[model samples]
Structure formats: structure tokens, C-alpha cells
Target: MRGRLRGIRLAVPLLLSAAVVACTTTVPGEPVSQGRVISRDQPGGVDPKSVVENTDGGEIDRLAATVVADLRTYWGERFPETFGKEFTDLGGGYYSVDTADADAPEPPCTDSAVEVEGNAFYCPTADIIAWDRAALLPVLKDRFGEAAVMLVLAHEMGHAVQNRTGAGLSERRADPERFPTILIEAMADCYAGAFIRWVVDGNAEHLQFGHDQLDSALTAVVSFRDPIGTEATDRGAHGDAFDRVSAFLDGYESGVKLCSEMTVDNRTFTLSGFIDAGDAARGGNLEFGQIVESITLSLNTYFAEVAGSGWRQPQVRETEGQPACTPDRQGPVAFCPDGAAVELDVAEELPEIHDEIGDYATGTLITSRYALASLAAAGKPVAGPEAQRAAVCLTGAFTGSLFQREQQFLSPGDMDEAIQVLLHYDYVARDVDGASVETGFDRVTLFRKGFVSGARDC
Candidate 1:
């Protein structure tokens, strides 16, 4: 796990810097140059081929052009109606020819030679949506069928939509444990569905997916799901098949309102009364203990399936009468061989504690939303509508579980170690009125902004 962690750097695209705006420049004979294109205030270098190919590269290019144009038109009208703001066109930039040989370094615009497998990306850096012709094109033709090619464009364009809206910027410096990569990718998928829905409604003549073709499109989407939930982490944000399809359907069925509702936010939770009561008996805040117990239980269950039966509980014995080791002892003093009691020195233990446990807060956030919503729907007072709204803020933390899992996979350890790491932190909750809600551990801060007013205690 440590080796995996060492290799796992957050592959957040360079374009993820929220401050940088993508620039577009036109090359002579480019399609965007011919269109009613809105140029950026500060133009950056662009690949000429990207623009030229869309205008002149036959059916695929034409199809790509139409998709881009239609999405622009759709959102241009939709944004004003929904948010009372006009949509700004981020200039579509073109790519130049490849200077590298077949085996040499490939140009950004020459997608044909690039490796596309497991790499469906939107290059905000280039201001061009590129598909590795070497990889993705073949998959579209053979496995996903011809229509999928358009869907793929729509999906990539969906990311472009996020960029146009402020959502892309909001998600820029995403804390892996605090934000779920799956949701981000899923939102893009939903945006694609919204675009498709627009096509089905607005321009059926230009673009059409037959019932059978729709099935194929659905299958194409299902192909991207990660079988194991391990991929739920931030670096591996594309969700499992079930979540991917669900998000797409969420947008397809209900449209933008549902999609908007899907954005990540900070949510809060109260410690259960039982857990609080137990803490009262211990004469110390039980919040940390409760968190540890919950995490330990969850990790134990998780590892039991993934690591199998070889997973052993760490032996913790009472240290009251532990014998002092002799100088002749060769092994490190941390381990107690005879008594099986590990004396954890608090000062030393504090620093060695892996802050990774904060990852659990994200997981808890993810799992708790649905749990709270379900509770509210089923008449749980604490999770009722007002509280549910407050609870929704925690979504950012919950979705963050995906990112945490990636970190965990990188530095695999016993479940107890993971729990101990997480238990060191605290959960804070604040009321919607901006007053601190006291929980046993400490006054949990309300991290959410713009919450609805007049909500009762959560």
C-alpha cells in the first residue's frame, strides 16, 4: 500500500488551476475562425489542426462541429432562463500538426498517435477537446458503435460546459477526501445526458439515437464503471457502473434541477445519543472514541473482504504490570513480546499518527447523506427537510471518501491503524443561523455557506 501511495500523485490536470482561464487563438483556415466565434480577451497558443479538423475532417469533424455548436446554443439560452446570466463562449482553440515521428513525441492536436486507453480527458490547457484517435476512436467504432462517437464528443463537451459555468472552477483545488471524484465525473456524465436530452427534444432532425442505439449508448457508459469500490477514490473518480448510470439517468430523467442538486457541499452530523451517553460515563468526550469505533468497524468489514481472513486484530493488552525490558533486548522497544501490551507513549504517538483518518470524514459524508435523507424521508426528526438541507453540506466530505481510498491503497495498513489515525480528528456542527451547535468533542464549525434560514437544531 505504501508503494502504491508513493506512486499515486493526484493526477489533477494542470488546467485545474481555478485562477487560469483557457485562451483561444485562431489559425488561418480554421473552422472556428469562420463561425460566429467569440474570441477570448487574452488569447493563448492553440493547435491549428484542432480547428481545421472539425471544419474539414469529413463526417466525424462535421458531427463534432455540430455537437459543439448545438451545446453552445442550448446553454446560451438555458443559463439566462435558469440563472439570469448570459453564457460566455470560451473560445474554441485549434491544434497544430504533430512534429514527432510515429514513435516520437506526439503533438497535442494530433490525437491519432496518442494513447487514449483509460484516458478520456478535456484539455483546458489547449482549449481543445481531444480523443486519442489511436485509442478511443477504435473503441467507438468497434465496441461502442458509431453513435457512441458522438456521445463521446457530447461527454467531453459536457466537461466544457462545466468550464463555462463556474462549477469547474469551484471544483479546481478539490480535496480528494473532501470531494468525490466519481461525483465530479458523474456530473459531467449528467451534463452529457442533459445535452443528449436537448438533442432529442430540440434537434431530432440533425441528431437522433434510435431505441436500439440508445441501448448501445447506455452500454458504452456502463463500460467505464469501476468494478471494485476502491476506484471510488479521487485519482480514480470515474465511478462504478451503477453510480455512473444512475447519475446519467438522474440528468436524463429530471434534467438540470437534479444536476444542480448534485453539486458538492459541506454537511454536518450529530453524534448519536447513545455514543454521547457512553462518553459522559467515561468523563471525557466520546466523540473521538465513537469515531474510532465506527471507523474500526467499517475498516474491519472492508478489509475482511479485500484482504481476506489473513487480517488480524492488533493485540492491545493492559500495561499496568508490564516488565521493563533488559539492555540485551535486540528488537525495538515499541513491541512488547511477553505481555502483549504495547505502551503507546502519547508524545511520540502523536506525531506518528497518520492524518489519513481525516479521509473517513469524507467517507462518512458520502454515506451519511443518503442515510440521513433516507432517515428524513422515513420520519427521522433530526434528518427532516431543514436538517437534510444542512446535512447536504456534508456531501463534499462524503464524496471525498473516493479520494481517501486512493490514499489508503497507497499506504495499506491494518484497519485499527486507519481508525486510530481518523479518531484523532473531530467533527464540528453549526446551526444555519451561524451559531455554534455544541457537540461533546468541541464546537464543530459549520463549514457550509448559504444554507437556508430558520432551520431548527440538527
Candidate 2:
């Protein structure tokens, strides 16, 4: 039985913001006004007239609509043929709200709610889907890729599918013990994969997932897993990495039937289970390895046949350089041809900026690059000594205020705020070199300023 619990809050603001954006627009082929996007922040605050200016909201909504439409079409056709019942249209809505609005009444049949720490979730009670775009989307873009936005939408939609079949809420409430928590979450993962397969298989128009794109999707799925082997059911809303990948593979291979086959009793665990079991064995618990290995090997064999040999051990080759060595070729090292030395320590030559900034500021590299690119694109003079470049990059008028605000405190809320400001600035500043000089900031100069400020502060 899947664990029965009240829907977890979708507290991640970025994700909710993204979902708000996604729920506003219609799918490419579908009519546009079918769904409405609500900024939970602006429940009554989201000006109806401002919808036109809500470009991000619109983009997210449109993308979500596309995914929703595709799912409807795929299941509409498939479900009827398989089960003799037309797939019910689970309407979608996006809400960005505070705690007060979160508990407010929801739309019928399908709705989702999103907040700062809550992440994203689908509510069966309201039959609505909600996400915190403010919390999730930015992280998705930074950690995964823009395509990960779609993966998120797919996950929520999987919940909607569960609602339609009455599998999600029922099993969650009634038979949780019969269905291990992992299997239930794995089913949703598989459903997400099925949607991806539908898109990549060309069943859906203009939606494609390339190999690189698939890697992004795979990464997004894998990141949700629990690293520890403890089968603590209540906390396992999503399966671990290996299980996620395999569940996705199950959908991609055998299609929807594989999803239908997932039940409380006979579900598979992740490949990492084998590794964990192996560790337990070395620690004198051979039974653990034997038990886990049998399950993993069996699942691997099944998926190998279903998804073909390629699914058994998908190879990932490095595109820009040799997989084993970075460009410098230093041991922890790289070969430096310019220095004409096989063992020259390039690590020393590389700037010690990362070390100086500390782990908390690790994302500064991306921020610096983006700031520089924006400034250079806008014709700002960024070239000079390293110190000059860093200064120019760090102290620009646009982001300087943000940096100041961030430096004032270090609470969890403050840290999150700082990260959002930096990430937003970085995302908008990407590839500014192509924009008109009058329009964009000078990327190089801006980066140099930022780098200097950061260095000086350190």
C-alpha cells in the first residue's frame, strides 16, 4: 500500500512561479483561453490587465499547456483503446500564493499549489495541479536545463493522471502498506517518462528531446532520489536515482502498459540498491546484497529486453574534451601543450578565485561569466588587468544594490533571496553579446567589476 498522507505543500517559490507561467497559456494546437494562470502572490493582486506583460508567466503556461495537451491526446487515444474509457480531461490551473491563499478553495478536478519551501504538488481533493514557479523554475534552469521545466510539468501531470485513474489518492490512502512508497512514486516517474517518450516518438508535434536534452531530463529525475538505503516510507515521495531512471526506462520501453503494471507488491527498486547491498555485504550482511542484487538484476534484465540493449548500459561520452582529462591535462592533472610540459601544474596557474569565495558562493563562477558577457555585449570596456576586470564585473549599478542587500545578513530567507537575485540576473544576462549595445549591459566590464568586488570582500 502506498503511504497515505495529506498532500505535501509545494513550497518552492521558483517552481510555483514557473508553474504559474505554465498554466496560463494554451498548448500549441489547443485553444489559448482554456486555462488561467494565477500568481499565488497576487491572488487578487495579479492584475487582470497585467496578463499581457506577464511574459514569463505566459511562456511557462504555454509550455505547460503543450505538455498537458500532449498528455491528453496520448492518453485520450491510448486509454480508450486499452481500457474502453475515454481519458477524462483533467483541467489544469497554476497558483502562486502565500500560506493564506494556499489553503483557499481550488479549481475543480485538477489544481496545483506552490510556495517557497514546499516544492510542487498535485491535489486530488481539488482535482487541481499547483506549483511554486518562484521556487522551482530557476533551479530547474540552473541545475538542469530549460527542458527540465517540461520534466517538472510532466511530473505534476503524472499526478493528474493518477487522479483520473483513481490510483494515486486511493492507493495512497488505502493500501499504502501493500504498495511500498517507492513503487507509488516510481509509477509517477514512469508516467513522466511516458510523456517524454510520446513527445520524442513524434506523437506530439514540435516537441523534441535530443540526446543532450535527454541527459538533462535524466539528471532532473535522478536528483530526486534518496541516497541512503533506509526504506523510510513516509519521506519517500519520489524514488531514488537508479529507480527513477529505470522507471523512466520502463515507460520509454514498453509504453503505458509498463506504467499500468506498477503495483504495491511487485515494483522494482533502483540499481543503486545493488551497490548499497554490496556495501552491506562487505560489512558482513551478505543477505542484504543478495536480496537487493536479485531484485536489481531482474529489473535490469527486464528493461534490457524492453528498451533494447542500449537501455542496459547507456553510454555517455564527453563532448568537449576527453572524459578522463580536462583541457589542462594535469593529474588531478592535465597536459599543457603551451607550456610544453607533461606534468606542469596548471592548477596553480588557474585563478584561486573559487577557493577565495568559499563553497557558499560557488555559483559565483556562472554569475561572473554572465555579468561579464552582459557588460561586454553592451559595449562596456571590460579588458584590463585581472583586478580591473574583477572590479568592473562586480560593482555595476544594476546588481550592486543586490549584493549590498545580500551582504547585510545571512538568514535562511536572506540566503535564498540572495541566490534568487543572483540567479535571475545571471539568466537574463546570458548571451548578451548578441543584443544591441544600446539595450544590453557591457558583459565583460560588468563581470570584471563583480569579480573585483567579490575578491576585495574575500
Candidate 3:
């Protein structure tokens, strides 16, 4: 994983910053972008060109080629009108490499095939896009599905779009502030979001997306976000997960025009590469034990305000093995009405999940239970559809508190972890009957409401 991380730096396009305004209008009649909507008619993957090699007629290359083709078509038509200039297709075209093949030919802008391992990138000087078909695509496909792969390609093509504008590598080097790397990366991310919207709208000939895939695509994009605490001004900065998602959402909700209009003045990113000695010593994350204790104290303080003076801190019980809550309230963790306590299967489930996701995943689980307690204290039933929604909303509220940098600090990747858990499982969103929000799309939207506006919104 570390090696792959290192290769990412090598594979990505050189960086730049930008300045622009938000576009208020997009396509006709489609004033608002249709977020998380899938196309009714599916246009399968594209045909592979001769530049792609080492494929035994596999679908991955065809998919990449198809996405590339559609992207060029979208930009080719949209770019001229948006920028008042002719859009240029990648001069060097697309190249697919089988990094696993020792004898495989190296792609342009690379010294060796190994450089492409676990990565994909676009070379501005050469005006070409390339990928490690054998390594990167398959891994992303397995981890986040094919939409992720499309997103990667789309993001790179976004870079090509940037080059077509006036902010290519030479322009960025000329004026770093005018085209900083973070802003440049955000623009690409936004462009990818816009392109994905095009696909979702059934306009593309070879790509399709739905709400579930949208969540997964967001997940994949978050995974590639610069590490938490990375400064927006850093040379390699690509925006924090929050900033990246916000940009993507802007494009999805608005359109390509909004993506083209993004500027540093209008954007806010939470990640800061610089940290004080105290935080540096902790490596941007608290241990599992410390996380539990700190979150427990924080939740008690927060809900005290929400539930009035009557908010009672539930007794936290950590049991071995998986939680064995009654079928009426089944989940990895639970808030027991009978005992007025929160129960966690800490020994294996909590710790393992924490390790798999991050501290915030556990934090989200525990906080959701606390949310139920808050509902109960406020004279609200903890066993209805509304209660379920309230629970998820309160979890978002707590997450918002963390976002505000309250008593409990959010680790760099914590928000992304919260997003992952919410989308991956419904344990935190469930009601007494083990029912919760049916779609990750709605679940994340509600969470975002509380996260952006605070508990009052919930």
C-alpha cells in the first residue's frame, strides 16, 4: 500500500491553482444537476484501440476506451462553447500498460513500466493519458467497482480539459498562485463529477451510473484524497476529502460550468498539512481506547445541550464477540432501552471494524446509539421510522461537531470513514425493528445536512 501511495505521486499530472466563480446555469431545463440518478438505458463499454496491449479481449480496456471516447465527445462539444476555443483531443492518445508483464512496453512520459504500477495519469506535455491496466484498474474495480475505474479515467481526462484551457503545466509554472495544485486538482475532480453527471443523464453512448454507483464513486474519490492534514497550498495538494467531495457535488448538482468556475476564494478545505507538535506526536489519530473515551466524553457534553438537562449518559458496555442484541434491535452496536445503556461488541467486532475502516467508524456507531438516547431524552420514541431518521441525523450532527473541531478532533480520514460505514452498512441507521434508510444516497444526504448545518438541522 505504501509503495502504491508513493507511485501515485509519480503518476499524477503536475499541479496548479485557479480562480473563478460558480456557474448558476447548466443544460436547458436541467437547472439542477440530477445527483445519484442512474441512466435507464445502458451503453456498455467501448472498443479498445490498438495502443492498448496485453489484453486477451478483456472488458477493462474496452471500458477505458469507451469512457475516453465519451469524455472527448462531451468535452469536444461543451469545451468550444464554454471557453470560446476549439477542443483538442489528447495529442498522444491513450495507452494501456500491463505492468505485471516484465516485457510490456512503457507508456509515454515514463522511464519504466514499473512507474505505472498501481497508478494512472495524464501527461500534459505529451497530451496523453495512460494507465496500468493489469494492476491499478483491477484493484480499483475489486475495491470500488468499475465506476471507480471510470472516475479515474474521467479525472485524468479532466486534466486534459484543464490543459485545453490556459492552465496547463507551463501556465501553472508561470503563475503558481493563479493555478495552484490544490485548485487544479479540485477542478479536475469537479470535471469528473460533471462528466459522471452526463453519463447519469443517459447522454453518453457507453457509460451508465445509478445512485449506488454514485456512492461508490464518491467512496473511490475520497480514497484518493490527499492524506488528512495536508495543506491546501502544498505542491502535491489535491484537496481534503471534504473539499474534494464538495467540488464533485458542485459539478454534479450544477454542471460543467460550475466546475470550470471553481476558485480558491470560494472553496474551503479542512485539511492542513501542518500540525502542532501535540498532534504530530499522535500521528493524526488517537488509539482505539483513547478514541472511545474521548468520544464518550464529547457525546455526553454535546447531547446534554440537545436533550436539555435531562440527557443521561448511557453506561457503555464492551462485550466480547459480536453484539447479541435482540432481533428487534439488531446491529454490531446497540442502545438498550431496558437498561438505558449503549452496548458494543468491543473485543472483536468494534476493534476489527475500527482497524478496517478507522476510528470514526466506531465513533459513528457509538454516536448513533447516543443519538437514540438523545431522542429518548427529548420525549421522542426510539422505535419508529422517524426515530431511525433522527438517529442517523444525530450521528451526522455529532460528526458535524467533530467537523467544527470541538473537544474531539477529526483525524484526516475520519469523515471518509464515516461516509464509508454509512454506505457500507445500515447498522447505525436502524430503528428498533432493524429497519433503516433504504438507500445510501438518502442516508449520505441526511448526514451531509447535519454535518453542514449542525444538530439543529437534524
What overall lDDT goes with each candidate model?
0.38, 0.40, 0.70
Ranking by lDDT: 3, 2, 1
Give each model a TM-score: 0.44, 0.47, 0.79
Model 3 vs. true fold: TM: 0.79
- What tens digits encode model 2's per-residue C-alpha lDDT throughout 1-458? 00010000111112232212112211111111111122233233223223211124444444544445555677777777655678776443444323234553333232432232235456565555554444455445456555565666676666667666757666556766765556656766777777787766666643555443464455455445443333425434344443555576677666777786787556644222212333433321222113222223322332233333334221212122321323322111122222121121223321232233221122232233323323333344333333233322342322333334423211111112222223222321322121111111133224323322442331
Ranking by TM-score: 3, 2, 1
lDDT (Cα, 0-100) at 220 in candidate 1: 54
Better of 2 and 3 by TM-score: 3
**1-458, model 1: which lDDT tens digit per residue?**
11111210011222322332221111111111011111232122122234433223543444445455556677776667655678765454422112122553433433343332323355554555654344344334455465455556666666666665655634555554444555566677676777667665645334544332444455555445442223244454455433454565566667765665565553211111111333224322223224333443443343233223444433322222321321212111122323223222223222223233333332332222232322233343332234433443332233223234533321111221222222222221211122222221111112112111111222
User: What stretches of model 2 exceed 4 Å from their correct place?
Assistant: 1-56, 91-118, 227-229, 232-237, 271-458
Per-model tally of clashing residue pairs: 26, 93, 9
Q: Across residues 1-458, which tens digit of lDDT does each residue of candidate 3 receive?
A: 00111101211333121221111001111111222222235344455754354444567787777777788889988898789988977778888888888778886677677666766777877777878788777666666667777778887888888887777777887988888877887888888888888888878866667765676776666666665556667777776556677677777778888888777677666566534655655445566776777788778889989988668878888767655554335476888776368878877767887887777788888898898889888888888778888888889887777666633367566776787677667888887667788776567767766777788877
- Model 2: lDDT equals 0.40
